[model samples]
Target chain A: MQKVFGRPKGLTEIPFHYCPGCTHGIIHRLIGEVLEELNIIEDTIGVAPVGCAGFSLDFFSCDFVGAAHGRAQAVATGIKRALPDRIVFTYQGDGDIAAIGTSHAIHVAARGEKITSIMVNNAIYGMTGGQMAPTTLTGQVTTTSPYGRDNGVAGFPLDLPKAIATFDGAVYVASVSVDSPKNILQAKKAIKKAFRVQQAGLGFALVSILSTCPTNWGMSPVDSLKWLQEKMIPVYQMGEIKVAEEVKGL
Target chain B: MSKVLLKGNEAIAEAAMRAGCKLFFGYPITPSTEIIEYLAKHLPEAGGTVLQAECEVAAINMCFGAAAAGARVMTASSSPGISLKQEGISYLAANELPVVIVNINRTGPGLGGLGPTQSDYFQSTRGGGHGDYRLIVLAPSKAQELYDLTMEAFDLADKYRNPVLILADGFLGQMMEPVLLKEKKEGNLPPKDWQTDGCKGRAKRKIASYFLVNELAEEACQRWQAKYDQIKEAEQRWESFYADDAEYLLVGYGTCGRIAKSVVLNARKQGMKLGLIRPITLWPFPVKAFTSHFDGIKGIVTVELNAGQMIEDVKLAVNCRVPVHLYKRQGGMLPHEREILKFVGQVFNLPVRGEA
Candidate 1:
């Protein structure tokens, strides 16, 4: 018998504490696989955000620094600037990146910081129960929006990847999903490329992953994936959003 | 190398560089803005990074990142800006990262003015941020002390794996005086085995403040308290001028301390029994300075640029052995020497000087 399948060396033995139906575990596995495949696990430093994403501090085998909510990019900026030779990345959720941390997100992209950021867009605040988030889709009901999110009152869900694509500093921007096996593989590819961009010292790179929150969405794990594929895939741009001339080579 | 004339803010920047600071993240604000400006111009030449962050909050978070990466880092701001950085500062304290923060304090309960004031004494000595944490606060009264204390702050920060704050007022920041740029001597600091640079030859490291389990959190708090206790024991610093054999003592820190020293000297020339006790470490509060010189003391007067904030600590230090009087000038106003002399004369029944 051959050992063809096992946990990635980049992940610790500690099991994840995510909700049963959550896609965070799958996303975590993808990142772990990417870190191992790149063979840069020993040379990379990661910054974890102040949400479910923050729990990554325990999962990744690479050196990690947990950042305050929405400030992961800022913290990553500090690390990368100080240790320019070491690869640095941030793991952040929609509420952590698109809400209170919005200013840091915009400025990090605008500054063309030589770092990678993975934005997991689940459209709701997961760790803090099902509350409304900036990425919450209009007409979507949440704990704070019992009457459903109204576009007139709550405004529209932010198209973060699209907005980030416009920044000249953001050399590589991709909107990926993990709703299917094929998309999961594609998400891993995009994540690896984001890290490659940093390894090359090209510029800022980001991969916004459309994720699922079954518990927060009030759906089963199976139905959550179905809803994400049906609704989210159509609303969000589904492929590489921006590839600067230099990033195109990578 | 040699004594050179420099503004307080500029001297602090130069001193930070000499102290092996490799990164500076700051936002430009009144009185303290020169610190960032000077570092932005000179730090790059020394192969250091100086970033003018979008705001104080971002700048301080950046300091958190660099410090965790084992880089000597600093950030500076004034009163309102420091308030903005409270969240990040709290995180830094919780994580026990080494960082030096400079607060060139301006008057404010809120954006009061840009003039010199020591109104931030409470915020600096007390943890400005949330949690049961403390920052070692160093108060420098003049340009020379500003340079010296800024250099020492980095060592103190690294020694304890905690944040150190240099607290000065707007007057000290803008005033020009001679500073001796002392040679840097390396302190025997513990190795940075906890830094998150990489895990190449070692196990992965995690720098986080979140302890989900209550027992783990409580243990962390106890560990930090032990470290703070050790600091309070070894780091109490103060200067006593003519305190020996004096009947009345005046107490102050930062710019007000310099003013109080002048008042003490002038009072002594007038044959009045006056003295000064200047606290250099405001957080440790230099209780030892008071108890050691308490004999034959009648009363203590606190001179400040705010509404008697440090007087509370002064009262605690003396333990109500003598009455503590407060002579303050608030809202960016400086306490005139003559007014302090008159107030002290009235309080202790001393003879009023000719100038008064």
Candidate 2:
């Protein structure tokens, strides 16, 4: 009998505090595995945003700095600039990256800040009792959108990966999903490549992961995955949306 | 080794470089814009990074990251821009990161004017951001003091593992004066054992301000309060000019203090018993400066460029031992020396002085 699988060295011994049926745990595990696989765990610094994503500070076995809401990109830019040899990344949620932090997100990409960003898109504000987020579907019902999100007043959901892919500084941009086993593996691959982009000193790389928030969506673990597959995958353009010639070599 | 003429903002930037500052992130704002301009021109040549952030908010957050990565970092702005940085400043305070923030204040409740004013005294001393924390505020009244105190701010920040603010007004920021450049001395600072550069050969480090448990948050607050208490005890700084055996005392800080000193000199020449107490550390308020000079002190007057903000601290320091008077000019107006002399003469019921 041999050990087929176990916890990755990139993760700490503490268990995650994510709610059951939530996809954040899976995303964290994928990042952990990527860090271990790259062998850059010790050379990496991570910035955590102010949401459920902020809890990743305790989960990752790397140097971490927690940033104010939506400021993760700016913070990561600082760390990357100060210690250019060290790899830096930011873990932000849709609400944190696409809403209040929109300015930093756009400018960080425009500056080509040679860092990786993992945007976890769960459609709604997970930690804040399911408020309407910028990534929420137009007709989706959230706590703040009691009557369902209306494009007239609240605006439609933002396709951020497509938007980011247009920037010249963004050398690699991928939209991923984790609803199924096959998709999970693809998400991990995209995440690893994103980190490799940073290792190669390429421009900014981002992997936008469409995650599930079962508690906020009022669905079971199984049902939330189904909902994400049926609703989010079609709306957000999936797979490598943009890849620069330099990133193709990686 | 030699004295050179420099603007206050430029001198502060040069001094920060001498103090081992390796990164500067700032946004250009009136009066304080020269700081970022000077750094952008010189810092890169000195093997440092000077970034102009998207906004003041982003600049301060960049400082947060650089400081957490164990780099000596600084960011500067004026009143409006400083207000935009309040959120990041609060996070820096809670995380106990050592960074330098310079606020070259202009008149403002909101975009009032670019003229020199000390209206930001309450904002600086009372913790402009949210949370139960305090920033060590250093007030420099001259270009020379700007250079000296900017270097001192980095040491104070590193020593206490806290943010230090250099609070000056536009008057000092734009004014040119001769500054004697001193050789950088090695400060006995504690090792940055907790920086987040890398985890190689050591345990992983996390720099954060969030405490999920209520009791843990309270404990963090207690720790911060203890640190602030120690700072208040050891860091109270002030300069006294002719305060001894004077019947009238004038209190001020920054540019107002510089002007008040001249008022003291002119009043003394007229045989009027006058003195000046200029606080170098505005947060600590220099309460000890008032403990001894109360034998014949009839009145204490605070000369300010704002509407009597520091007078509150002056009143607290005096403990009502004598009446505290306020002679202020708001909306970017400077309190002229002659007008102050007239106000003092009226308040104390003394004879009119020369040139008034």
Q: Which lDDT tens digits does candidate 2 get at residues B263-351?
A: 99889888898999999999877998998777889999999888889999888888887999999988888888888888899999999
Per-prediction TM-score to the true structure, in the order listed: 0.99, 0.99
* Pairs in steric clash, model 1: none
Per-residue lDDT for A64-105 in model 2, tens only? 999999999999988988899999999999999999998988
The Cα local distance difference test for each model comes to 0.92, 0.93
Candidate 2 CAPRI level:
high
lDDT score, residue B349, model 2?
A: 94
Runs of candidate 2 exceeding 4 Å displacement: B354-356
